[model samples]
Target: MPSAQDIASKLAYITGQLTAGGTNAQMKAWYDEYKKLNVELKEAKAMQKKNPKDPNDLQDPKDLNDPKDPKAT
Candidate 1:
């Protein structure tokens, strides 16, 4: 049960790894792994709808607010 922050962190980590230079084969492997993680994060987020949050639950952080957001950059 990953929180939104956890998903964001994972996305950032993988993005950094891909941008960091690597051999073609190594990049391919990272890409494949990244894809898997992307799917997992999506699934985890979808589950959030089913398990209603408690009244005290924290709100999700908007990626758009990030200064380094891809669209912003």
Candidate 2:
């Protein structure tokens, strides 16, 4: 899977091509790619939000650090 930044760059390039004008076939292809990248970017964002990169952002409910865990020291 491409990173969000890479997707964004591709989307920008597509937008530029669309704005510059092209044959109907070329325009259609670029437009399709743009839509696909848009969807991928959204999915990438959702995944990033669901899984944070920072270790501190993660929590294990069963870990000994949990105050409510009976086995916690």
Candidate number achieving the greatest TM-score relative to the actual structure = 2
**Model 2 regions more than 4 Å off:** 54-73
Task: Kindly give the stretch of ten consecutive residues in candidate 2 with the minimal lDDT sum.
Answer: 55-64
Against the true structure, what is every candidate's RMSD? Answer: 10.3, 9.8
Residue 41 deviation, candidate 1, in Å? 0.9
The residue-level lDDT of candidate 1 at 60 comes to: 45
Candidate 1 backbone clash number: 0
Clashing pairs in 2: none
Model 1 lDDT per residue over 1-73, tens place = 6665687687788789899969999889888878977887788677666664633236745422577667666
The residue ranges of model 1 lying beyond 4 angstroms of the native Cα positions read 54-73
Question: Pairing residues by index, what is the TM-score of model 1?
Answer: 0.60
Residues 1-73, candidate 2, lDDT per residue (tens digit)?
A: 7667778899999999999999999999999998999999999778778875734333344332767667766
lDDT of 1: 0.72
Summing lDDT over every window of 10 consecutive residues in candidate 1, give the lowest-scoring window: 55-64
Question: Against the true structure, candidate 2 has what lDDT?
Answer: 0.80
